[model samples]
Structures are given as C-alpha cells and as structure tokens.
Target: MNDLTLSSLTGRTVLVTGATSGIGYETARLLAERGATVLLHGRTDGEARAAADRMIATAGVNGERLCTYGADFALLDEVHALAARVNANHPRLDVLVNNAGTAAPERHTLTADGNEIAFQVNFLAHYLLTHLLEAALTSDPGGRVVNVSSSMHRTGAIQWNDPQRARRYSRVAAYAQSQLALTVFAADPRVTAVSVHPGVCDTAMLPLYAHEGCAPAEGAAHLVRLCDPATEIVNGAYYDRDQRVEPAPRATDERTVKRLNKLADAAVGVGS
Candidate 1:
C-alpha cells in the first residue's frame, strides 16, 4: 500500500456525482475545502445549484470554487449531455468520482434505457460518462477515476445472459451486480481508475448495510484521499476505506474485465 499523503488540491478540478446529499455531498465538500474546483452533480439542475448554495453557506466554500451540473443517471441521454457540458467547459478534468448510486427498489424496475433501474444508474451511466469524457480525462497525467463501489459486490455474480434479472429478480442481487460491474470497470486499460468500498455510511442506503453506521463525512474521507494525486494508485485496485484490499476474484480477472467492457459498450451505445 502506498502511504498516501493528502495534499492541497489547488488548480485541480474534480467532478462528484450525486452530490446533492449524503456521502457524495460530503465528498464534494471535502474536496472543495482542499482547494479543488469541485463540480457538484445532482439529479436536477435546481438540486445541483441548491447543493452548491448549501456548501457555500455551511462549509465556507467559496462560490467561485464550485460548479454545478445536473444529470439523472437513469437516463443515458442526460448522462451524455452532462459529459458534453463538462468537456466543453473544463477541458482538463483531474478527477471523476462516480458516487451516484441507489439501492435496488423492493420490486424490479426498468429505466427508460431498458436496463434494470439500479444497474443503469449505478453502473451503465457512469461507464458512459467516463468514456465520453476521455478527452478531458486524458488531457493530463495523474487524472483518474474513483468508483464508490461497495463491499456487497463480493456477493454479486454477473448474470451474463440476464443482466436485468428479468426472470428471477432479487433486489439485493440487482444492486450487488451493479456494484460488481463498477468495480470490474476500473480494470479497463483505457483509463486510470480504482474502486473503493467507502464503509457503511449513515445515509439513505444505510438499511442495506447495517442498522447503524458511521457519519457520511467519515466515509467521504476515504474517497477524498483517493482523489488526491499524491495517493499512488494502481488501476483496478480496490480499497476498504484507507486500506488497499483485494476485491472479489472476478474484479481482477482480465477476461472478465474485457467481457464487461464489451457488454457495457453495447449497453451504452459506445463503439467497441
């Protein structure tokens, strides 16, 4: 494990999705405090702007250091639009925090994109966003992606032929599958990326983990650390909070990584 020292983020730009609330909000706040130009993404424009306002008010973050973007992860077109706006506005993005996610609803639901709701929001949208922002992301060295995956991914198995789980649906399985896919995505050779389980945070999704959980900021700290350029990262590495740890076996498998890229490219309408 590289002993990561958190350094000033001056002149760096970071985008954190789902920044309207919970861990995402805190992560954005911490990054902004550390001098990064934090882009706060929410499900809607108003929500994103509101998050920025709150940050400015409570965290003492300068309004000048923050920007807001809105995109509903369940909608692939919106994700593309968000990426386009970012690339046009900030050509040299330093970090992308794929933190927007949702718990699988009690019943199976599908997005307008025809994917399982959780799968689309938690994985496919991010996959598309990352690939679309390749120009900005690769504009400089040390630029990387940080996936806020989960430990629950260990229980997940990619339902290769039935990713939607249309025939046999379980909310737990659906959410885990999405997370596993995100973890596997970090291994793609096209970009520098890593995934981490940010611990059981006290947020809307707390029920999925435990009855009680730690503060959202505690979990956000782990994410902020990885976003720092000083934190040496190996592509595809998975961390549990601040400690590097092995992810599920399939997460590191080269064959699985390539296979997943194909599946995601088709799903997101990206060329292989």
Candidate 2:
C-alpha cells in the first residue's frame, strides 16, 4: 500500500458511484491505491468490471478482493436494487461518494419513473441510495456521505408545483435544480453528509456546456480530501472545490429542505 493511502484508508470500505470515468474514475483509483476496499459503480457491467480490473492491477490487490456494481441511475428500480445488493453484501461502509451525474443541456427528458432524467440521475438515485444504505454507513464509527453537487446550483430553484418540470423545462434548469436538491438532502441529520462542487473538470459532461476547466485528477483531489477521515469540514456543509461556501439562498431555506424531503420520500416510496 502507498504510505499515504495506507495510513488514511487502510481497512476502510468506500463505494464511489460513476467511477468508470472523469473525477469518479480518478477518485476510485486514488482510494484503491491508498488501501481502501473500493466498490466501483457504473451504469454498465462491462465498463465497471473493467474499471475494477484496472484498480486491482494498479493497486496490486487480489482480483477477488475488488468488486464492481452496475445500475442505470435513470431508473429508480435499478437504484433500489443496487442499494439492496450493497447493503446485503457490505454491512459496513465507511464512505459513499455520490459522484454520478448527467447533463442534457439542450432539452428536458423524463425517466421511466416519470421524474426528469437529470433530476433522477443526479439527485434522486443518490438520495434513495444513501437512505437505503444508512445502516451500513452508520455502523461505522466514522462514516461519511459525499454528494457531488455543483457550483452551477447557485442560481437554481426547485419548482414546487412542477418538480418534474412537466410544464416546461431546460437542461440547465433541470440540472441545477437537481444539484440544489441534492445539497439540501445532504443536510439530513441522520448522516454526516458533505456536498461538493468538484470544480469544472475536463470530462465528457463538459461538452454539454462547451466548457473546460481543471483536470479530472484535480477535481477528484477535492473529493478525496473530503473523504479523508482527518479533514475538518463541517457535516452537512457545502464546498466549492475544497473551500466551504454558502449555497444559494434557496438551498439554505428551511422550507426548501422540508419540501425536498417530502417530495423525495414520495418519489422513492420510502415512507409510503
């Protein structure tokens, strides 16, 4: 094990979603290198398995010790099944990095679940996953949930009357709304959650907005820092890159949090 990773992450188990590419991919590799048992997730079996293989080889861990899981975040059923699988197999999870996201900057689309695709993929799936796996996380003495939000959410607001954006929608609005909701969800008192803006990294999603920013490694570094057990970030706070920042006023509003919780509970059929 690399000395740094070995010291900070050895014996810890971390699950990073969207680990097949971009910041997620780099974050998984870094965690694996540091000696954490990393569960890599993707929307496809082949890509996730391949990522697992690379991590095993790179980290010099036994192939049998590394694992991968798949689920299409666009589908809530798949998200539930994923949570069940992880909860069943890994009873103790020290960290969960909800880094998966989508960008449909041109238009709005709906998932089979009737929720906006970006809303479901970027926010709802992760919200449900974290809720279902709360036990696994809380079982550990020092557990953390890192939600990958974005600075773009600064201008976003959830449409209370049209949460699905069925009346009218744009990719930008949907994406930002989803991100803001996610940051709000992270405020759940049941878990020690930290939401982050991984910076505008050069990734596949960048082209959706025709923007370029930092390297994926640089973006992943911020996530890795938050995941570090020794870091001093306040639970339920938001960060831009590594610096904590105030989210949009709507995100901090008390009513905003409650309304989001109610909607999420209904969307995932949690309390029903």
Candidate 3:
C-alpha cells in the first residue's frame, strides 16, 4: 500500500499463477490497474479466461492489459507447456509470481508424476516453471521472481529420503514441507528471486492460518510492492507482508538451497 500509483508499472509484464481466485486474483487486478500487462493463470484455460473477463467487467481493467494462461500444476507436462507458452508469447517477462498452491488433502494423494499432491502442486510445479522460463525471466535486468510462501515453513522439515511421504503422511506436515521448499528455492542462484508470507488473508487457505483474516487485497498489496522495480531487493530475501524479515533458518541455508534444487530437478524431470 506504499502509494503504488498507476504509472509505476507501465510497460512491465507480470505472470501470476492461481490468478482466478483469492489473493492471486486481487494481485492480478491491482497490477493491471497500475498499468502492468498481467497474465492471469488458472487450472484450466476456461477458468483463466473467465478471470480476465471478470476483471475487465467488474474492476474496469483494460482487456488489452490482461491475458490468460492455464495449466494443471498437478502434472509436470502441463507445467512445461505453460512455461513454453509464456516464453513464446512474452520474451521479456518482468515478474513471475509463484502463487498457485493447494492444501494437502486429508487422505494422502499422489500425482501421476509420482509426487505427493500438495508437494507437486505447491512447490515442484513452480520450481519447474520458473527454471523453464529462465530465458524470458532473465531477458531484462529488472526481471525477478516472487514466491508467495508461508510462515508455516518454520514448522516444516524436509523429508529428504522420502519426499513423497509414501510411508508416513500428515496433511499439515505435507503442506508445510512444500512451503518450506518454496522458500528455500528463493535462494537459487539461477534467478533473482525472493519469497514472502503475504499475511493471513480471508482466502481459500485461510482455515490453515486463522479463524478470521484480513482482506485478500491487503495481502496482495505486499506482493505488488515486491514486484515494483522502484522497490530495491536482494536476491534470496524473505519478507513478512511489507517488511523484509528472516525466513526459517533452513530456508536461507546455501547447502539446503542446493540440495532442494537437485531434489526438485529430479522430481520434475528438469534435465531428463
């Protein structure tokens, strides 16, 4: 909410995943209103298009400033396709917001790609998408990535040997682990990136945080601030809402960051 005026984002292009609902939707709307060309992503093409249409109709966002893209993050193939489409369409993406996520189901589930459902959807998919879009993301000096991580990462520990948790599984632990890995990924040397906890907001994931929460727009304000070029940032930094703060100790460990990259690359078939 730091006076992010309309002219602040002119000529910038941002891609926000999970943009069909909650904080993601509000973030996309705010960016588009501020003159950024926003790409809205959802689980499917229909859902993404509908979100863009809704923004145009209700928020008065210019249709020309919004575009729609979709891919089911549960599948690695779809994530690759999503990245390819974005790279082909926008050669110089200014910001990539890794916001798509899902709560772990009570009954443990596994994706066809052989990863825990929450792990694949919440972390691995974005990991792959971000790596694949390297050419476009690095096309400009100002390009960067913003990971919408969570404070819950503090309670999580990576199950290095059995990341899928095939032998033992708890919904809460699974979700927390995914968020922790995402936070650690910010330290990756491949791209200039940072992670943030956008505050507990009244969104689909609110139940995981608290009984009551602030509005989605309030959470989105923090994200939009990080995306602004005027706001200086350090690679691998973590933020709590609008304040730059330390993340979980493990998240900033260089060794952990390298290990997570290796694990994620293998899990997502990055080099294969």
Candidate 4:
C-alpha cells in the first residue's frame, strides 16, 4: 500500500453510486472527510438527498461539497437519465466508484427492463454509466473508474448463449457472472479502470449471502486506497483485498470481452 491517504483527495470530485448505505455509504463518507467534492447516488432522490444531509451533519463536511443524485439501476432508461444529469451539471469527475450491487438469494428475478435483476444492477448499469461518463473521466489523465467486484468472480463465467441466465437461474451463478463482467469491462484500455474485491463485509448483504468479514469502513478503505492518486496500480488490473492479483482466466480473454461488450451494447440499446 502507498502512503497516499484520504487527505490527498482534497479538491477532487468523486461520484459514488448506492451511497445510501453499506460500503458505498462508508466510502462516500470517507471521501468527503478527505475533502473531495462528492456526489452521492441512491435509488431515489429522497434517499440520496437524505444521505448527503446526514453526511454533512455527522461528518461536518460542507453541504456544498456534497450533493446527491438518484436512479434505479435495475432500469436502463433510469441509468441513462442519471448519466445525462451528471454530464449536464458536473462536466468534470475525477473518480467514479461503482460500489452498488445486489444479491438475491432464493429466486430468479427479472427487472422491468426484461433483464436479470443482478446482471442489470451489478454490471450492466455500471457499464452504461462508465461509457456515458467516458468524456469526463478521460478529461483528466489521472481519472479512474473503480469497480467493486469480488473474489467469487474467479468462479464466474459469461453465459454466452444465455447472458441473462434465461434458460435457468442460480443465485451464485448470476452474482458471479455479474462480477466477472465488471472485471472484464475494467480491462478495456481506453480508460483507467480498476477492479476491486472489497472483501466480505458485514452489511445488509451478509444475511442474503452469509460470510464473515470486516466492517464497511474497512472495506471502504480498500477502495479509498485504489482511489489514491499516488497508488501505482496498473490500469485495468484487478485487486483482491487491496492487493493486485490476476482475475479469473475468462476475465482476461479478449474474446470474452468482445462478446460481453456486444451483448451489453445490445442489451442497453447502444451500438457495438
């Protein structure tokens, strides 16, 4: 780990999705503590605004330095709308932390958009958001797209024929697939993307998928480390518990990236 600490974030701007609670909330809170102008996102406007206000009251971070945006990730149209709003207002974003994800334990659920719920919320939504914000990210050569993936992705695979797991559904398979997709997309050379396995933290998701781990603050620290400008992590690399490691073989395959990109483009109504 580098010496670049949260204090180094002074004056930078970061947008964190799912900042309402869990790791996302901790990450956003710490970043704001570091003096970054942070934009918090939640599934609804009230949720996001309330979260930002709470941060101000609890952390003493200036209200002007922190704001909120809302969008339901399970819907493609809402994702697009959120991106447009961000671009229209804040044209310069130094870092993007895609910390939002879902874990549905027992059932196979479909989004209103007709896509698998996990796939849409965890991976596809972030994919669309990243592309839409490419301009702002690339504007500063030091900008980064930090994707919160998981070590479980090592067992993940792209269901090429059934990208949405339409044929059959397994909670484990869907969650793993979504994480793998995020890692694969992070490997794209056009932008500075970093994938992170934030560890199994004790959060609301724990009951849904039980595992022993640290608190949200500890997990958020791993993300903060990656966001540190002085940290010399190679772009498009995967980090497991703050240490860079090779992801699953499929995540590094060129063919896998291409196929997934194509499918994602089609799914989001964007051209390949």
Candidate 5:
C-alpha cells in the first residue's frame, strides 16, 4: 500500500481504454489516486506501457492498480483478446470505460478488419468490448459502462440502411455516427451505460476539433462521478460536461440499440 488511499473506491475496479492521453488518461489517473484499481488501454505496446508508468509515477498509489493493454480498437479480434485478458484476471468488473476514439482526416481508411476505420474504432470496438464483458458487469451488484462519447453525436444519426458507411464515408460523419451509436448503447439497462463528453478537454484530439473551449480534466469529472455507484440513476444518458443531455431520436430507440449490438456481435463474433 502507499500513502494515498482512494478508499472511496476501496474495492472497485475500473477499465479505461485509450487512457494514455486526454480525458481517458485524466480519469484513470484520478481513479488510481483514490483506491480504484484502474485498467488503462492504449493501441500500442509503447503507448500502453508508457501510460501505465505515467499513472504510477504520477498517481503514487498504494498497490500496483494501473496497468496498460495494447489493443487497436479498429480491429475486432484485438478487442476480443483485450476483453479476454481483462476477464481472465478480474472475476467481476465494477466499471468498464470505453474512452478510445479517433477522427479520420478527409479520406476513407479501412482497418485490418475490412471495415471503415472510424466506425470500427469508435463504435464497433466498444460494442464488442462491452458485450464480451457484460457477463462480468451484470454479475456484480450493478456494474457501469461509461462509453466516452461527444456532443457531436447530436450532429449525426445511425444509418439503419447502411451503418458500415458502404456508400461513402466522411471523417466527421463517420465519427459522429459511431458516437451516436455509443450514446444508444449507454442507454441500455441490462448493464448500466452512459456516454460522456469530456468537456472539450485539452487532449491531443483537440486538433481534430472544429470548435474549442473545454479542458480535459474538467470534462473528466463527470466521468468519475458516473463511475461512482451512488450515481446509478444517471444510467443510459449522454453526459455533456457534468449534466446529462438527451440523445437524438435514433439514439433513444430500443430496436436500434439492439440492432447495432447485434451487428457488433457479428463483427466481433459474440452474443448479448
């Protein structure tokens, strides 16, 4: 044990993906500073290892709680493996955070999994990860899945006709669609889920932003609260900063959420 004790999270465990930087990083750091054993995710070994080191070096926790996993969210197989690794060690997960995301630059880039890059990384990856971990989450008193999303979700909707973006993909459009789906996923009650906008934090992704203002730490505060069990009623909502905002009409559909979850399962090969 160390000098700092986040006794508030004395026995809880949280997994944060894309945690090497920005909002995800800040959230993981705060959780570690307290008492929650946080699992941080990065897409590369170097990034993952570096993030874990930084969390430890910076947080100064009692036990070694912050560790990193290198899984590219753009690939389904990798997500499955990432889930397996987490499940192998933790019997039940108190918190599962889907915080990794990216925006493509003006071009259509396909990932190794043969799907649009933005779609796969932002939505599909989180979808598979959450489904695979549902058993772990639901097995608990009532686990939470904090799907890191953005206010941009209001700018787009799910293409019930073709979610894969088979016709044409724009960077903004693709990313927005994924986030919208994330918002929908978070609303499901089988396992508590909520999508959060990290309040325009000063993370690396800011370069991708058309507008600016919010800092990452400020945005992460809401995410931290969402992780707390006391805030159970906030489930299935999209958090813009600290307050919950309504998702688009498409995001509020049970059939759409279920359909998207099914597509995600087929892509990653799993079930609800």
Candidate 6:
C-alpha cells in the first residue's frame, strides 16, 4: 500500500453529483487520480457524459472508472429515478457527494415540480436522493455524505413558514437560504452529512453568481479531504480549507434545526 500514490483510490466508489463543473469536477478529478471508481451525476446526460470524459481525460485514466448518472436535481421524480438507478448499480456507494447546486438569478423560479429552483436543486434534491439511498450510505461503517455549501449561508435565515421564497425574492438571499438549509440538514447523526464552503473558485458558477475566491482546485481540495477516513469524525459541521468553521447562529440553534428537519421531512414526504 505504501507503494501506491495518492491516485491509488483502490476499491473505493464515489458518487459525485454536479460533477460536470466547478468544485464538483475538481473533486471528481482528484478522486479519479487517486484511483477511486467515481460515478458522476449531472442534470443532463450530455453534460454528465462530458464531465465523465473530462475527468477521465484529466486524471489520465487508462479505462473508464469514472461513470455518469443523469438526473435533474430540480425534479423530485428525477431524483427518485436516480436513486433507483444508483441502488441497482452501486452496491455500496462509499461517498455521496451532493456537490451539484444551482442559484436562480430571477425571483422565485420554480422547477418542473413547482418548487423553488434554488430550494429544489440546492437542498430538496439532496434530501430526496439521500433518503432514497440511505441504506446504501449507511451500509458501510465508514460511509460519508459531503454537501457543497457556501459561506453565503451565513446571511440567510431559515424561512420555515415561507422557505420557498413564495411571497418575496432576492436571488442572493434565496441562494443563501438554500445553502444554509444544506448546512443545517447535516444535523443527521446516522449518515454523516457534511457542509463545505469551497473558498471561491474561478468556475462558470462564480461568473454567474459573482462569487469571490481562488480556483476550483483550491476549493475542491478541502472537499476532497473530507473523503478521507480520518476526517469521518468531522461530520455535521461546516468547513473551509478542511478546517472546521462556525456555522451561522441559525444553524447552531437546536430548535431551529429540529423545525427545519420536520419541515424538510414534510417537503420530501419522509421522516418528520
């Protein structure tokens, strides 16, 4: 084992949603280089395939270890379909990286299922997917779930009564709330749910959202570290550069977290 390089992620299988671009792609590439069997998940087949190819190309793989699963995170039906596919194919998915995310520049955009796009894509989608794959995630004692969040989660409040941003709208706040929800969602004790702020990378997402930071690789490195078994105890926390950081006051509120859990369960029609 000592002879193996860092790219020797042998025997490990990782499923990274939103692996097409940004921190998602960088994390996939890093895992691939380490020899992990990475399953790429994206909203579209074309994008997902492209990202899988890119990871293979970038990681200098000989055969296809990185795969793709096409699922639109913004839709509950798609999330269900994805769960079925993943369960059937992946016996024990080592890591569930909820890295795929979106932010709406417009006010209160809804998905095909009529939920807020940001809420659905950034938070609800994972809620549904993870619930469906709970068995797979917890099957292994060391299984992990890493959610890519943003520092913007600090500025927003959990609008339990109006989480969908139905009556009002600010693109930034909406996005921030979604991210914040992700952070709070990590409260689950069974399957380790982790949140990360990738520290400003120059990805297309940054241009659209105008986020400030270094590069995708730099931000992704922090996320990648969470994949290590040593970091397993760092669950249920927010991180930057692999360092545990304080979440917003709202995230730390036990009552608020319990309420959000109940609300999220109701939204997903599961554990309430």
Candidate 6, RMSD to the unseen true structure: 2.7
Candidate 5: tens digits of C-alpha lDDT, residues 101-180: 88755777878887778878888888888878877774455478888888888898777677777786777888888788
Task: List, residue by residue over 1-272, the lDDT tens digit for candidate 3.
Answer: 55776346989999999999999999999999999999999999999999999999999999999999989999999998999999999988999999999999998899999999999999999999998888888545668999999999999989999999988999999999999999999988888999999999999898888899999999999999999888888999999999999998889899998889889989987762
* Model 6: per-residue Cα lDDT over 60-165, one tens digit each: 7644777788998877888898999989998688888888888666756887777788888999889788889887775555578988888888887777778878
RMSD of each: 1.9, 2.4, 1.2, 1.7, 3.3, 2.7
Ranking by TM-score: 3, 1, 4, 2, 6, 5
Off by over 4 Å in 5: 1-7
TM-score of 2: 0.92
The estimated TM-scores of all candidates read 0.97, 0.92, 0.98, 0.95, 0.90, 0.92
Query: Between prediction 3 and prediction 4, which has the larger lDDT?
Result: 3
TM-score of 4: 0.95
Per-residue CA lDDT of candidate 1, range 1-272, in tens? 22222478899999999999999999999889888999899999999999999999988998999999999999999999999999999998999999999999999899999999999999999999999988898536668999999999999999999998899999999999999999999988898999999999899889998999999998998999999887889998999999999999999899999999989898899996
lDDT values of the candidates?
0.93, 0.84, 0.93, 0.85, 0.78, 0.79
Best by TM-score: 3
- Lowest summed lDDT across 10 adjacent residues in model 2 is found at 1-10
Clashing pairs in 6: 7-33, 7-34, 8-34, 9-34, 200-213
Backbone clashes, each candidate: 0, 1, 0, 0, 8, 5
Residue 116 lDDT, candidate 4, scale 0-100: 90
Pick the winner on TM-score between candidates 1 and 4.
Answer: 1
Q: Between candidates 4 and 6, which one is better according to TM-score? A: 4
lDDT of candidate 2 over 196-228, digit per residue (tens): 998888997786445767889888988887887
